[model samples]
Target chain A: MIRIGIPRALLYYQYYPMWKTFFQELGAEVVLSSPTTQTMLSSGASRVVADTCLPVKVFCGHVLSLVKECDYIFIPAIRSVQRRVYNCAKFLGLPDMTKAVIPESPPILDIDIDVNKGKRVLYQAIYKLGRHFTWDPLKVRRASIAAWQAHLNYRELMSSHSLTPPQAIEKMLGSSEVEPKTHSSHSTSTQGTIAIIGHPYLLYDEHINHRLIHRLEQAGNKVLTPEMLTTEELESAIVKLVGRAYWTYEEEVVGAGGHYLESRIGGVIGIMAFGCGPDSLMMDVVRRQAARLNTTPFMSLTLEEHTAEAGVVTRLEAFLDMIYRRKRKQVEVCV
Target chain B: MKTYLGIDVGSVTTKFAVLDENNELVTNIYLPTQGKPIEMVQQGLKQIKQQLSNGADICGVATTGSARYLAGVIVGADLVKNEITSQAVAALQYIPQVQTVIEIGGQDSKIIIIRDGIVTDFGMNTVCAAGTGSFLDHQALRLNMNIEELSRRALDSQTPVRIAGRCTVFAESDMVHKQQMGHRTEDILYGLCQALVRNYLNNVGMGKDIQPPIVFQGGVAFNQAIVKALREELNNEIIVPPHHEVMGAIGAALLVHEEMVNSQNGSKFKGFEVSEIKYHTSSFECKACPNLCEIAQLSINGQVLAQWGGRCDLWERSQSR
Candidate 1:
């Protein structure tokens, strides 16, 4: 069987299950690059311009690590997910960038997954991807249907259990008979509710985010993320925040931010790459909305290549201190 | 005569404050950190021990600032708090009605927006040291003058020239250009101060409601020119409270005092002889994972007291076990 390599970065957290299912049904053995590390990040950073965001650098690193391990590397150019809303430019040019930078890389299986190009183009792209493994059109159609079902199941598992993508992915991919642990219900806990708004790449990449979700959970604070909300809920929140969604991924930051700010969460944190253009604009909108609301505390944490954990720790600790103290004061007033 | 000891180990300075049971500062010591946190902390402790009154007994101990963990382990602190909370706590103690706090330290600066004795919002300088005291200190060194003289000379300016304060390198070149263009030295110095103030307001104090009674503290409060620039820009009186330089230490001391009072436990202080304990510090790269975390270790007399800095708490947990 021809082994296909997948870089576990960027859209991997969002669409990995579907990609794995689609490729497996086509009879290709799917191989994944290891989780990110210091060496991976440094190697990736060397391959790209200094101004490129950290996520892109990480993606480059993942691609480099997969050089000798697979027959074909899969990289899809996802330009737009909705009718008019568009992804950042980096996503549109990822395949070309990887090919240009890594001259010794394996043959890349490239696909353009732009929804704005209409249903025919989308299906044609899927068919072309499947045709590489099998000549039967019926098999291709079956694989696509299986991929869609897997994606829906992935989304369902995340929202129902209030799990991050990695958590949900682990359960579905891990032992079949083992029951997944249910997260402590957020509704019962009134205090220490923190909403972390960021892209999945930034939120789930333990190396990039410094294990942010684990740290919060360890500290006994109930954490919330954009993935836990339904598509309709996020869409309405985005409309309420900025009239309409401009960026394809704006729902992660702006929509979730607007909804959380209105809710009675203790605080809201916006995490983003240092120079991401879309994130900068979306985060600013959230920050301003937070200021207008003035009911919940908001803080923005910018991640870069710097490995100094002291700065991030200090900020997180102080933000938590502020929340706990405020909650304590409210309790005192009630008594 | 029970007192609480608070130590703030920052990037540029190490401070020690001894506060009595009534939250009154009995003695405080401030000195340049000079990149040797352990040595500076020891020296500050020695000085504080000498200055403290004879009858004062240390009832609690706390640590704050960037190197707080190291200092906490060394001093056997009862509390370890972030500088933001410590600064706010001290500000609230100094003036209960304080709505804003602008703390400009050696390497970084932060703005805290407080309402009804709670921190509502806060922001810190990100990846830039342009609007901090160290920048002023560097300019003073370049001009062959002390930091105190820079402030005095800046106060004498009649018409200040505008220097670009967006980047420290550009700001240095801008200062040189202004000086070559026959601008008075005092005018250039004051211009640099205004530029830093503008950068602070733009970067660290962005998109927040900054209200008065605004109490400005930290090492930068010593510079009258920066204080004046802040006042001019905000069109409100910027109050620099007494003991501004030692406010972080005071806040830590105050927090520990509260903790000790509630718990009814004796202080965890290791005594003033920690200055003579011959402490040793070292670091090693952990090979447990591909992250290669550089873990820092602190020991005394060949006995490891604590280890930290790893992404995972493997070493930390092992030490505890």
Candidate 2:
């Protein structure tokens, strides 16, 4: 069986279920690069230019790791996941960037996921991807349907439950008797909730964000994230904006940020990667909205490869304390 | 009289401040850390005890700065806060109407923006020390002059030369080149100051909505040349509050006062007796995986006190601290 390597960065959290199911249906063994590490970050940082965001640098390292293991490495050139919205420029240029940086890597299988050129273009891209493994078009169609269903189910599972993408993926992949990994939830805790708005790559990548969700939970505050909301809710939260945001993934973060502003949550925290253009724009929008409402406390953390854990922890603890003190002051005013 | 003590164990200095129950500064001390934070803190503790009158009630204690965690466990702080929050609180205490705080320490510089008496936004310098006090200190050393002399000499310059200060490495070479180009030392000093201010505004203070009534604190506030450059760059009068060098300790003290008043708890202060406790810190490389994380272990004599700095907390959990 042909081994298909997938770098565990960027679109890995978004389309892993679909790709894994599709390749497994076609009898190809799927190999995922391990969770990010300091070594990987250093290697990635050394290879790429200084200004590349932490996630992309991490992506380079993951690709480099998978090169020696698998026959073919997968790093999709994702332009758009939905109509009228484009991914970051880096995402669109990912395939070419990989080739330029790695140079000695195994052959990369590229897929165009843009819906702007219509649905048929997407199908054609998938068909081209399937041709590498088998010559049957009918088999590819069936595999595509299964992949699509797996993606929908995965989305449903994550939205309905407060599961990080990695945890949800694990739940989907595990056998019949195995249970979903227990996320340290705040549902039982009486403390005030904090809504975190960020991409799945930052939220689920524990190494990058320093297990921020778990840190919040341990600080006696409930945590809410963008991944916890369904598509319908996400859309409604974003409808207040004049039009769809230019960046696709950031629209979801802004929408969730909007929702959290009107929510009973004590604060709003945004974890953005350092030097992310789309996030900076989206975060500015969220900051303006939060400023206008002036109810929920807002904190924005820019995480890079060298962002110290102590610094993050200190800020988080201080923010939590500020919220707690503000809540108490509010109670005092009421009484 | 009741007292609240705050200790700020910074990268380059250790500071201690005691505040009365009425939120008045009683006494404060500043000493060089010199790569021995624990000893400096202990010496500071001993000095503070001697200064205070007998029967002064110690209400609460707080720790702030980079080494706050270790200090908290050592001195048994009632509260531990980030330097940003501590400094903001201290700034607000000094200048109630202050909207902006520009703090430059030894190795770090931070900008804090306040709105209606709350820290709305803040930014810290990342990957660069050009905008901080140590950068100037290093330059002063290279010029065979003390930091205070550098500041005084800089004030004598009529026409200041511009030194590139985007980075420490770049700024040093640029300074050397300017020296070879027949520029006066005082002129170059002012140029260095201006360069640092420019780098700070462009980097740490970028895109920040900097309002007036700005209060500049931290160790670098003592450098009049940098302050002059900052005032000229912003075109506003910069107020350097009294006790600016030890504002972090003052802030931590003020925070402890508030926390004690609200929580109404007895202080966990290890007392001035902490000076007797011999603290030792050592590091070992964890051979887990390819990433060899250097885990630091703090011990009190033969007993392991705390373990920190590993990606995984397997060793952190190994010790109670």
Badly placed stretches (over 4 Å) of model 2 are A46-52, A67-69, A96-107, A175-190, A232-242, A262-264, A291-293, B173-184, B261-264, B288-290, B318-321
lDDT of 2 by residue, B76-154 (tens): 8898889988998899999999999999999888898887677767788775678898999999999899999999999
What DockQ values do the models have? 0.77, 0.39
Task: Return the clash pairs for model 1, or none.
Answer: none
Model 2 chain B: ten consecutive residues of lowest lDDT:
B312-321
True contacts kept of each: 0.82, 0.24
| Candidate 2 local lDDT, A1-335, one digit each (tens) | 89999988888888899999999888899988888877887888889987889999999988888888998988789888877887888999998899999998899899888899998899999999999888999999999999999999988888888876777888898732122223534446557888889897898787889878777876777777787788777777777853566778754578899888898788999889989988888888888888788788888888987788987887787787667766776687799
In model 2, pairs of residues that clash are none
lDDT of 1 by residue, A1-335 (tens): 99999999999988989999999999999889888888999999998977889999999999999999999999999998888998999999999999988888899998998888899999999999999999999999999999999999999999889988877888788733122333343344444889999899998787888878767776678889999988888888899989999898899999999888998988999999988999999999999898887789999899988845778888999999999999899899999
What's model 2's lDDT at A191?
77
| TM-score list, all predictions | 0.97, 0.90
